[model samples]
Target: MIDQVRALFAKNTFLPCDVSTIADDADLYDAGLSSFGSVQLMLAIEETFDIELPETLLTRRTFASLENIAEALSGLVSKAA
Candidate 1:
């Protein structure tokens, strides 16, 4: 899931630095992820994972870092199962 999310970030986000080099828990916003980039990433994640994130989960906190994104996706995937 992390790898998938990482790949999605690489393809979808506007981060200035290499997504792979960012720490899993690092703040993506500080690394150059804009609000629009996060939205694009959210869409990409939904399409890739085949899960829709709840409205409540669509927040900066959920998309704050690679680890957070994976964690949010994990919960959504489990619930979908």
Candidate 2:
């Protein structure tokens, strides 16, 4: 999951540092994740996971870091399951 997120950032050329080194709790925004970058990440996540992120899930807190994004995806996957 983290790899997917990192790949997305890498593909967009928005990541500022080693994405693999980013902690799950790291603040992506603080780590140079711009609004546009976030949206791009969101799209990539949706496509990779094959799930639609509802509007309610689109928030700074949810996409704050790779861990948060994974948690959100896990929740959505579980609910679907």
Q: What is the TM-score of each candidate against the true structure?
A: 0.90, 0.81
14-57 per-residue lDDT for model 2 (tens digits): 66776777787889889888898788888887887788999999
lDDT of 1 at 38: 83
Q: List the residue pairs that clash in candidate 1.
A: none
Question: Which prediction has the highest TM-score against the true structure?
Answer: 1
Q: lDDT by residue for model 1 over 1-81, one digit each (tens)?
A: 788788887776468789989999999999999999888888887888888889999999998998999998988888888
* Candidate 2, number of clashes: 0
Instruction: State each candidate's clash count.
Output: 0, 0
